[model samples]
Target chain A: MLKRYLLSPGPTPVPEKVLLDMAMPMIHHRTSEFSNIFKEVREGLKPIFGTRQDVLILAGSGTAAMEAAVVNTLNEGDKVLVVNAGKFGKRWVEIATTYGLDVITIDIEWGRSVKPDQVESKLIAHPEIKAVLVQASETSTTAYHPIEEIGKIVSLRDETLLIVDGITSVGVYETKMDEWGIDILITGSQKAFMLPPGLALIALSEKAWKFTEKSRIPKFYLNLKKERKSQLENTTSWTPAVSLIIGLKSVLEIMNKEGLPNVYKRHALCAEATRKGLMAMGFELLAKDIPSNSATGIVLPEGFDGGKFVKLMREKAGLTFAGGQDHLKGKILRVSHLGYHDFFDTIIALSSLEIGFSQFGLKVELGAGVKVAEEIFKNHLGV
Target chain B: MLKRYLLSPGPTPVPEKVLLDMAMPMIHHRTSEFSNIFKEVREGLKPIFGTRQDVLILAGSGTAAMEAAVVNTLNEGDKVLVVNAGKFGKRWVEIATTYGLDVITIDIEWGRSVKPDQVESKLIAHPEIKAVLVQASETSTTAYHPIEEIGKIVSLRDETLLIVDGITSVGVYETKMDEWGIDILITGSQKAFMLPPGLALIALSEKAWKFTEKSRIPKFYLNLKKERKSQLENTTSWTPAVSLIIGLKSVLEIMNKEGLPNVYKRHALCAEATRKGLMAMGFELLAKDIPSNSATGIVLPEGFDGGKFVKLMREKAGLTFAGGQDHLKGKILRVSHLGYHDFFDTIIALSSLEIGFSQFGLKVELGAGVKVAEEIFKNHLGV
Candidate 1:
């Protein structure tokens, strides 16, 4: 029997402890018992979010929270700047346009992060732009954009807000929201939280609250103001995905044990190992400059189909990796080391890649990547 | 340790098997293994929905599916009739109105269901009503509408479609979607599904598919055509709530073992016992004519606080019941006998109500209601 291994960018493996905790008897969300747990989980999210503000939980995916951020903070005719670098980055543009926003899309080339100067120029060109929407870590390209620099640039504008989709970034890297002047930060449960998708976590600063007060967009299920009011009372505005939040509490407890610095460092090590492993196999990364410490995107070698390679890995080796989305489709494969992953998982991922490449009739030595991953683990013992 | 029990109308207790299955391990949604499982789950949902049509799985709550039904089935500014009986029914009006539907509300009183003849009369008067939005079971009042008769009336009109909020109904009662000519039927993973709230299951008929083709409402995340196409390929369009769908498969398997008729019988027995138990304690039901067979709503006795009674049940005894919403708040307590509950649970719920009332100085006879529940169980067993 082939052992199954998941290396997808979003649904990274869940820890057994968290899983078992979620498996216990379900508790009603309105109870004092659940309210206390919700309170603890919210309080614990502060360091991971790097914010003093409330990190509210939603019952839907990160996309829902993305919609919530837009519709709750902007009016119908307001102008907004979207940094479109990858599939997720393009989502912001779509959501903005759907809400009748006058969108000024700063389309960053696929697989490339936007330079802070590019965004500043666009904002200067369109002073009416109310918010600058971007991805902290573009999942489609495994590119970590310089959100810190963008935050600094956007903060210079009195009326502009910086909204970051940190779906795969938070808990994997540093996103000091309060200090960086980031107005809205969003994340999903399936990434660094080591839980399944269903819960979207978003935190808003006092500056963002100011935007909500004047926003004229219509919203019901995704009104962050309503959700925030409910969250302050240690509850959700509506009936939440109760089991997922229980799992979230368990995951946050585990994150608390590791601490923020160590948690980010662990992700950095795993991602570094995976990237080095793929590069040692003579494979190029899809990211143009800097790579994310959450997932590694490897460009398919000549004559290799990214989709076929990923499918073959899953079918033959029981290894699951994510293929590219949108413009990058059939050209890149993304392997995540975000949560419940270690240096050893990088080795297994590399080994599967090596075996998969050889099976596809490409002349490459098997274990070359695995050896690199092993050495990185040995060298980073202290880290 | 007191025995903890969840008797809330929405987040009814999760069956251990389903919870454990969800907690087992995380699987990547793109993998063939997961796709195969998704296909099986989709096919299995037909019998549960009482339809031969495809049942689509969504990653959000029932409200999302309700929104999907509205935004996908009708164009903006299309005239629609909403049956506003309780909180959830009013949700349809809110969603339809938010999406720019010209809403005509058929207002049902707080604790009553809509009459089919009245709906027919309204339809005859306003043939321009393109859709009728409603709930199969109004959770706020525990009132079950005559969905079968309403469906029959709406089906006679070529231009009109019936959209149902079966959130707390489908698995609790047999929703014969195909036979009753239901255009759109929706339900959630919680309630009678024996799982937590995260996934929403919706089925659409052929006429509803026709509506989606010409609908002009904007939708990105809740796009059914995209979701349906992906499901046919044995996957989801977006990153679905993978763990919850896995749990749904497990619950469906258990339901299959019990058979739909038997499952309905179980819910009927539990709900009947709950109603009789409360009635025996001289408690009045909120529903005027017919109460939902899923949850029983008991009106507050003279000088009794519904909130205090429920709170005392949770704190003193480990029992959880649902209080009212909107205008009915602090006036009614909903005792649910949905899935994952049995006759013994009905006894516990009544005992808690009795004990909670006595402890709150309401002067109710303890064990009087539980005695009726015990008798119901014994007589049903043919003992």
Candidate 2:
């Protein structure tokens, strides 16, 4: 029997405790029992987001929260700046344009992060820009954008809001939303929360909340204003994803037990090990300059077939790694060091890569990658 | 220790087997394993919706699907007809108006169903009416609209679509979407699907699909056209609620094993028994003319505190029931017979109602309601 391993960036392995907690009998959302849990989960989310504001839990994917951030904070025809660095960053452009926002984009090359100067320059050039939409970690390219720096640049403009899609970066690294001057921050449950997909957690600063008052974009389900009012009373404007919220409460308890700082350290060490292992296996890294701690993208060789390699790794080794998307398809393989992942998972991934590469007729020594990953993990102990 | 029971509409009790299935190890969404389950679920949902069309699965609550129906089908400022009978019907009007639809509503009494002649008259008066939005079962008042007659009327109009919110009706009764010529139908997992809230299943007919082609509403998260294309390929446009989808597969399997007709019959029997029990206990039902098979709403006695009564039922009797919303608050109590419920659950509800009523200084016989419910179940056995 081939035991499967889920190593994708999102839909990460769920902890048994969280799963069992969610598996318990369903509770009515309007009851005190549910409200109590909702209250705890909301408060628990603030620390992860590093925000003093209420972290509104939406019953949709990260994209839903992203849309809410756009429509609720900006009016039609309002000028917006988007940093289109990768697939998710491109989504910001798409969402902004869909809402009739005049989108000015800084299109960086794939596998590269946008510089703070570029955003500052765009803001200066377009003084009417109301919001700067960007991703903290572009999942598609595994590139880490300097959100803190960009937030600093955007916060200086009283009319501009810094909206960060921290779907892959929030709990994986230090995402100080308030300290970084981020106006709006968003993340999904399937990412660093170590839960299955569905729920999206978002927090908006006082200035961003003010934007909702004048925002003219028509909305019903993803209405952040209604959500905020209900959530403050320990309820939701709509029926929330009850099971996921229950799971989120348990996950927060787990995070608290592990300590948030240690969780970040663990993810950092795992990402470092995975990177070192890939380099030792004679692979080119995609985001070498500012790689995200959530996942790592590796450039495939000229003749390598990424689809076949990923399929073989799944079918033969029972390892699941995310293949590249769009232009990067058949060119890279992304291995995640996201939530519920450890150093051993990185070892297994590197081992599978080495074996799969050799099977694909590449000159790769067995255990070379695993050996290097083991060393990095060993050195991290500081013994 | 109190043994809790959930009998609220829309977060109805989840079966043990389905919960256990969802508690299994998480799987990556882009994998073949997940695709196979998604494909099966998509097909399974069609039978429940009673449609030959592809039923799109979304990772949000029922309101999200309701919003999708409006945004994907009608453009901004388009005229639409809403049958405002209860809370859910009001939701259709709210959603339609929120998306800039010029809403003309036929207001019905809180617990009364809307007449088909009124809808036909509205359609006849305003041929420009783009759609008729109504609820198959209005949970707030336990009212069921005549969707079949409304569908027949709307089907005759080439330009008008009939959108039915079947959140508490689809799996509880015979909806027959295609047979009734419904343009768009929507339901949530928490209600009759016997799953936790998160996933919303929506299906559209050819006419509604045509409406999407000319629609100009700005949307990103609830984009039906994008979701339809991806769902046809056994995937979702965005990350789905993975664990909930897994549970839905198990739920479909259970429903199929029981047979759809049998499932509908079971819900009908339970609803009938609940109504009889409440009546025998001297409680006046809110919807006496045309009641919903999903839940039953009973008007509270004069000078009785509904909030206190509901709390006592929960804390003292280990039973949870829903109180009315808005103007109906403190005047009604809604007990659900939807999803994963049996005749015994109705009996339990009736028993609690009798005890709670007697304790509240109302002249209620201890076993009056339970005796009636038990008799109904016994007679149904044909012994």
Candidate 3:
């Protein structure tokens, strides 16, 4: 009998506890009971965001918060620097361009980490740059850019703000928001937060709030300035995703019990094992430099059809992993080790990969990959 | 011991079955399973919206879809007629103004509906007006506007689109999107859909879609044209509220079983009973001209203390109803008879209202309201 496993970077498996917490009868969002819960959620999120600033919880996907970050921080025709390394980085360029911003895009290679020196050069070239938009860990490519270095560069510029897409990064790694001087950071519920994907969590620095006050973009639902005002009163500006927020409270409590550092270490161990295991299976690692602990991308071997392989995994073993996007489609696979996952899941994924290879007539290493993973797990400090 | 009941106008109680559907094991949104369900939801919403056009589901509160309707169908500096009747109507003005629309507002009384003649006169004076925004039922005042008549007027103008906020109206009343020539219509999950408040359902006519193409508003997340393109491929432009969408599938099935006509009749019967019941207890209704079937707004008697009465209901009887907003605060109370509610619920609400009245040191006729509601239920098609 085969067991079903969810390994998608997005919509990661939610803890059953969080699911049950959300499943309980929903209370009115306008009530004091919910307000207290929301207030707690707001405060709870600050530690994870590594900020003392108020974090805004929105009733939409992560893209909604990303859009909120863009439209609420820059005015029309404002210039910005966007690092386009992967899918989400491209999204930053897209959103900025869509909002009539003059974007100076630094097009880095896919699956490659962006150099902060490149941003420094571009910012130097564009004196009017209002913001630097990038992802902490690009989910599509599993590449972690040096956001700390980028934050250092942006912090030196009085006119420029740093906005990080922490969708798959926050709980998976130590995203030192306040420490690194990140002006705006965004995350989603379904990632390392271990909840459903409806709620978008956003945190802004005091500088970002100032930019929000000056931003002239037309917004009603995603107006963070207004949201900030209502949040100060222990309520949301609009009706939030009540069930998801309740789930967030419970999930945050779980993370608190596990502790943020331990959560990061757990995800790191799982991701490292997965990456090492894939390499042992004769698969090429997608991100050669600074691979993310959030998810691991693998380049399929020559003559091994990726689309057919993924379809086979799902049909044969009930295993679902994300396939490549854009130009890399049918050439790579991504296994998510983020959120509510551990070494056991990594072993299962490796076993599933081996089964997929043998079924496709590719050379089978048997448990060679799992053995590599086992060695790493046994030797890992925390484990 | 008192049983808890949810009677808020927006976040009406979710059916236990629907909640269970949401609580079931979460599924990947990118898979065929979720796509099939989304397709079903798309088709199911068309009838309730009274249109053949595909309704786009957004992962946000109804206000997000309202902003989408405004931003996706109009350009900057476009003249529009806003019917400022109540809170929701005022929202139309706020969104339009936020997007830099040249708004010609028809300011009506808080509890009143817009007169089409006034709109017609305004349209005649302002020939450049591109759209007219109004609500089917204003939740705050519990008043139903003359959307049918307004639709007739807007339909005559080829340059102007009719946008209706059906958040509290769609399943509660006959919106008639196609029959009445509504160019845009929107609804929320927590209202007539009998689900949590995360999914916003929006539909656009061919004309509205055309407007969407030409709309010059700076938008990224609320872009409907992008959403429509992706929806054609059986997916959303972004990750949606998957659990709520799953719950939506079940709730829509329940709604289909009840039938739109029967649902409307049920809401009508309940609202009529509630209004009559309140009046029987010597309390006057706030909505004098056109009371809505979705909810009932009652005017507190002089020196009766509406706030104290609502608080008493919650404390002593475990009942929750909506207090007034803005100018109506502490003057009126709103009782919702929207989705997942029945005649028995109406009786319970009436009994709770009577209990609250007596507890607040106001003269009560004991079972006067419930008796009236019970009599109406007995005479209705089914008790």
Question: What are the DockQ scores of the candidates, in order?
Answer: 0.68, 0.91, 0.78
Error of 2 at A62 (Å): 0.4
Q: Taking the tens digit of each residue's C-alpha lDDT, what string does model 1 give over A166-274?
A: 9999989976998998999999999999999889899988989999999877676787898899999998877789888888889988888877788898898888888
* Residue-wise C-alpha lDDT for candidate 1, range B1-383, written one tens digit per residue: 98889898878888888888998879988777788889889999998888988899988888888888988889878999999999988888888888788999889898888999989988988899999998998989999999999999999988999998898889888779989989999998888898888888899999999999998776777879988998888888778899998998898899999888988988888888888889889888898877998899989976678887778788878888899888888888999888898878888888877877887777789899998888778967645
Candidate with maximal DockQ: 2
Arranged by lDDT, best first:
2, 3, 1
Model 3 C-alpha lDDT per residue in residues A1-383, reported as the tens digit of each score: 86679888978888888888888876788777788998898999988899999988899999999999999989878999888999899899889899899988889888999888899889888878999999999999999989999999898877899999999999898878988989999999988998878999899998898888788877899989889899988888888899999998999899999889989999999998999998998888899889999999998877679888887787677888999989888888999998988888999999888877887898979898999999888965563
| Model 1 docking tier (incorrect/acceptable/medium/high) | medium
Comparing 2 with 3 on TM-score, the higher-scoring candidate is 2
Report the poorest 10 consecutive residues by lDDT, candidate 3 chain A.
A374-383
**Which runs in model 1 stand beyond 4 Å of their true positions?**
A365-367, B362-367, B379-383
Work out the TM-score per prediction.
0.95, 0.98, 0.98
List runs of model 3 lying over 4 Å from the truth.
A379-383, B381-383
How does model 1 fare in lDDT?
A: 0.87
Supply candidate 2's per-residue lDDT for A192. Answer: 90
Which regions of candidate 2 fall more than 4 Å away from where they truly are?
Answer: A379-383, B379-383
